[model samples]
Target: MIELNQVSAIQQQTQVFNQVSLKIGYNERVAILGPNGAGKSTLLKLINREIYPVERAGSYLKLFGNETVNLWALRSKIGFVSQDMQEDYTPYTSALDVVTSGFFGSMGTHAHLQPSDDQVALARTLMKQLCMDIDEQRMFQRLSTGQKRRLLLARARVHHPQALILDEPTSGLDMGASLGLLSLMRNFCGEGRAMIITTHHIDEIIPEIDRVILINQGQLIDDGPKNEILTSEKLSDLYQTSLQVSQNDGWYRCWHG
Candidate 1:
């Protein structure tokens, strides 16, 4: 389980979130929604330990029911896929090498400890599962934006972490690519894994999502089951705009006047 008790985060002298509290139990798939500048990305950074909360604010961030688990040890168990994948790719690395690099937490390009043949096979399998057919030997820098995002996410899962954190995983994807990514995410939800995805759009919410967390202006606005928190009235109130929300099959759509 992941728990945040009265947690606050500050970066560059700016308060990102204030006194936010949330709990995510095992096997829960959560979608985080908010308007622009709501600190959604910052919150994901907090979970990944990219930044720490201010000590004077009496904030606490805990993972897996423990107060003091070694963060490095904990990191190996969490898969993080962020929107910022432009900086890590190299012009010369092959696709297979890129995926293999994820086994040791490298950014899909850098040289690290060699992964085993079984790991290589798994990487290829994941690529096939995602409907991607790029040459395994193709240069990393040559793939399209959508391909990069999918490859990066597949890299994160090479270790099969206990939890997954995805920040705007489909931000730049087209319709086909987005569906492929969402399908892959749904396949990850099971009896023992946990996932927290930060996204602002309705289409990004997977059908397997069990909960929703809403934030605005760096404060947690709502946190509850997806069925209860994603209503038209609640979302309109949260975004401070008149919006129509509808459910089709198991997904949601937002209609604007």
Candidate 2:
């Protein structure tokens, strides 16, 4: 489980978050929603320890029930997929190589050793499951925007980490591909594994998600069951505009009036 205690972040003298606290448990699917510049991305960064929150004296953020662990040890258990893939990926690298590098769980490995056969096989399997059939040998820069996003997701799951944190996983995907990605996430739930996704679109919130965390101006407005907190009234307040929140066959849709 990942827990936060009065977690707040300050960057460049701006308070990205303030006294925020939340808990993510096993089999729990959480959605962090807010308008752009609402500190949604900053909150994810705080959880992964990518950047420390301001005045985080003690017990600000705890991962896997530990307050202290070696940096490398902590990253090994967390899988993160961010929208900014250009910086993390090698433009000329192969799709297979991109996924295999997830085992290293860092930007890029400096070693010259080739990945083992098992590693390569696992990468291919993940790609197939995500509906990514591009040639494994294709250069990373050659794929389209949506294809690149799917490849990054495969990369995150390559090592099979216990927790998956995705930022705008469906940013550039079409309807069919977006649904496929959500299905892939639904499979990740169970056996002490959890997935947290941050998305602005209501349609991207999969039905299997058990929890919803709504943020506005760096503050948590609501955090509870999807059905309970993701309603017309609550959503209206979050966006500060009238919205019609509806559900159809386990999918959510919200519209501005």
lDDT of 2 by residue, 44-143 (tens): 8887777886665654677778766566666667788887754467788877777888777655545774678998888889999878867888888898
User: What is candidate 1's lDDT per residue for 1-257, written digit by digit as tens?
Assistant: 77888888888899888788888877778899998789998988887778877674556788787766776567678888887644556657787887777777666455447778899899998787766667889777888877887777777777778888998888878998898788888888853678899888987898888789999999888888888888889989988889888888889888885
Task: Give the distance in Å from residue 212's predicted Cα in candidate 1 to where it truly belongs.
Answer: 0.7
Off by over 4 Å in 2: 56-59, 86-88, 190-192
Candidate 1, residue 185: the lDDT equals 86
Please give the lDDT score at residue 142 for candidate 2. 91
lDDT of each: 0.81, 0.80
Residue 43 alpha-carbon offset, candidate 2, angstroms: 1.0
lDDT of 1: 0.81
Say what the RMSD of model 1 is: 2.0
Count backbone clashes in candidate 2.
0
Report the Cα RMSD per candidate: 2.0, 2.1
